[model samples]
Target: MPAPTEITVHQQSRVLEIAFDDGTRFRIPFELMRIYSPSAEVKGHGPGQEVLQTGKRDVLITALEPIGHYAVRPEFSDGHASGLFSWDYLHKLGSQQDALWRDYEARLAAAGKGRDDAMPGKAGGSCHSH
Candidate 1:
C-alpha cells in the first residue's frame, strides 16, 4: 500500500488532505472521520457491534500525533481522542466519503437524530473529569 507522504488538516474546511506516494490524493471531511472512527468506543470489539456516531458536524481537530509510522491520532475539540487513523483506513474513508456520508445521513434520519443530538446542551461540562 502507498503510504501517506503528506497530510494537511484544514480547520476552516474541516477536512484532512492526504497525499500518498503513488500520486493519489484525497480530501476527507472531519465528520466522516469522527463517525467512522476505528476506536473500540466507536467500532466496538466485534463485527455488527458498531456504534453510530452523531452530532459531530462541527467537531474540530485540536492536534495530530504520529503513531509508530503507521497511523495518526487525532485529538478532537469535543474531547474525543481515542481513534487511531491508519493509512489504509484513511484512504478508504477518503475514497468512499460520498457513499458513507449518505449512509450516515440516512441512519441519522432513521434514528430521529441530528448533528445537534450527539452532544449535550452546550453548557460545557464533561463527566470525564476526575
Candidate 2:
C-alpha cells in the first residue's frame, strides 16, 4: 500500500481526499467511509457480528485529525469519533468501496432496514454486535 502524503477533508462536499506519495489520489465520500469504519463499534468483536450502520446517509465528517503519519482520527458530526482510520485501511476502503457498499446495501435489505431508518441515539437501530 502507498503512504498518504496529504489528506484533505472537504466539509461542504462531505468528502475526504487522500493523496499518496506515489501520486495516487483517492476521493472517498464521507458517508462511505463512515459506514465502513473499522472501529469496533462497527466491525464488532468477531466474525458475523458486524453491525449495520443506518441513518448515516446524512452523516458527514466534521474533522480529520492526524495521528502521526500512519492514521487519521475522523470526527463525525453525529458525535462518533472512535474509528482511527489507518493508511492501509483507508486505501483498502477506497479500493473496495463499490463491493463493500453493495454488501452493506444487501445486508440492510436482508434485515429489512432502510438507510433513513438509522437515526442516531436510537436503541437497536445500528450497532456492532460481536
Candidate 3:
C-alpha cells in the first residue's frame, strides 16, 4: 500500500486531502470520512458485525493526530476520535467513494431510513428493530 506523503485538513470546506507516495491524491469530505470511520463504533470488531452509521452529514474533522508512521486518528467535532484511518483504507475510500456512497444510500433505504431524517452525527440508534 502506498503511504500518504502529505495530509491536509480543509476546515473551511470540511475536507481531508491526502497525497500518497504512489501519486494518488484524494479529497474526501469530512462527512464521508466520519461515516466510514474505522473505529469499532462504526466498523465493529469483526466481519458481519459492522454497524451502519447515520446522521453524520454535518460532522467535522476537529483534528488529525498522527499515529506513528502508519495511520492518522481524526477527532470529529461530535467528539468521535477513535477511528484510525490507515493509508490503504484512505486510498480505498478515495477510489471507491461513489460505490460506498451508493451502498450507504441503499442500506438506508433498506433500513427505512433517510440521511436528512437522521440527527446530526448519529448512528443506528434511530433504526427500528426488525
Candidate 4:
C-alpha cells in the first residue's frame, strides 16, 4: 500500500480526504472509518472477537491529531479516540472502500437494523436489541 501524501478531514461532512502520492484521492466517510477502526475496542483481540459497532451512523469526527509521521489519532464525537489510524490501514480502507461498505450494509440488513437505527432521537430510530 502506498503512503498517504496528504490527509484532509471535513468535519462538517464527516469525511476524511486522503491523497496518495500515486494520485489517488479518496473521501472516506466518518462512519465507515469509525466502524473499521483498528482499535482493540472495535477490532478486538482476534478473529470472531470483533465487536459490531452500533449507533455510529451519525458519529462525526471532531478532531484529528497527527501521530508521528505514519498515523493519525481520530477523535470522534462519540467519545472514542483511541484508534491510531496507520497509513497502511488508511490506504487499505481507501482501496477496499466499496466492498467494506457493502459488507457493512449487508450485515446491518441481516440484523434487521439500518444505519440510522442506532441514533436515538434522529428520525425516531432506536437501537436494535439482540
Candidate 5:
C-alpha cells in the first residue's frame, strides 16, 4: 500500500484531502467518514449487527491525530473518535466513495430512514468530558 504523502482537513468544505506517494489524491467528505466509521459503535462487534449512523450530514472533524505511522484518529463534533483510519482504508474509502454512498442509501431506504434523521433513543450528551 502506498503511504500518504499529505493529509489536510478542510473545515469549510468538510472534507479530508489526502495525497498518496503514488500521486493519487482524494477528497473524502466528512459525512461519508462518519457514516462509514470503522468503529464498534458504528460497525458493531458481529456481522449483521451494524449500527446505522444518521443526522451526520454536517459532522465536523474536531481533531485529527496520527497513530504511529499507520493510521489517523479523528475526533468528530458528534463525539465519535473511536475509528482509526489507516492509509489503506482511507484509500479504499476515497476510491470507492460512490459505491459506498449507494450502499448507504440502500440501507437507509430499507430501514425507512433519512440521512438527517436522528437515531432513536439517543440521549443528548457528550461521549467525552472536557
Candidate 6:
C-alpha cells in the first residue's frame, strides 16, 4: 500500500487533505472520517454489532498523534480518539470516499436518522480492537 506523503487538516473546510507516495491525493470530509472510524467503538466486536455514528457533521480533529510510522490516532472534538488510522486504511478511505458517503447516507436513511441526529443513549464502550 502507498504511504501518506502529506496529511493536512483543513479546519475551515472540515476535510483532511491527504497525498500519498503514489501521487494520489484525496480530500476526505471530517464527517466521513468520524462515521467510518475504525475504532471498535464504531466497528464493534464482530459482524452485526457495528455502531452507527451520528451528529458528526461538525466534528473536529483536536489532535493527530502519530502511532509510530504506520498509523495516526486522531482525537476528535466529540471525544472519540481510539481509531488508529493506518497508512493503508487511510488510503482506502481516501480512495473510496464517494461510495462510503453514499453507504453512510443509505444507512442513516434506513435507520430514520440524519447526519446531525444525536446518537441514541450514550456512545458505545471502548475496545482495543482498533
- Per-residue lDDT of model 2, residues 9-119, tens digit only: 888788899888778788898888888888888887788777788888778887788898789999999888999999998888877888988998999899899977854
lDDT of 3 by residue, 5-66 (tens): 89999988888999998989989988889888998777766776667777787788888999
lDDT of each: 0.86, 0.84, 0.84, 0.83, 0.93, 0.89
lDDT tens per residue, model 4, 4-105: 888898878878999998788889889999999999777877776666677787788888999998899999998889999988888888889999989888
> For each candidate, C-alpha RMSD in Å?
4.6, 2.8, 3.7, 5.5, 4.7, 3.2
Q: Judging by TM-score, tell me the better candidate of 4 and 6.
A: 6
Q: After superposition, how far is residue 32 of candidate 5 from its true place, in Å?
A: 0.5
Model 4 TM-score, 2 decimals: 0.83
Residue 47 of model 6 has an lDDT of 87
lDDT of 1 by residue, 7-71 (tens): 99999999999999889899998888999989987786677666678778899899999999899
Error of 6 at 94 (Å): 0.7
| Alpha carbon lDDT at 13, candidate 3 | 85
- Give the lDDT of residue 53 in candidate 1: 83
Over 1-130, each residue of candidate 5 has an lDDT whose tens digit, in order, gives 9899999999999999999999999999999999999998888767777889889999999999999999999999989999999999999999999999999999999999999999777658424232
For candidate 3, the lDDT comes to 0.84
Candidate 1 or 2, higher lDDT? 1
Whole-structure CA lDDT of model 6: 0.89
* Residue-level error in angstroms, candidate 2, position 56: 0.8
Count residue pairs with overlapping backbones in model 1: 1
Off by over 4 Å in 1: 120-130
Rank order (by TM-score, best first): 5, 6, 2, 3, 1, 4
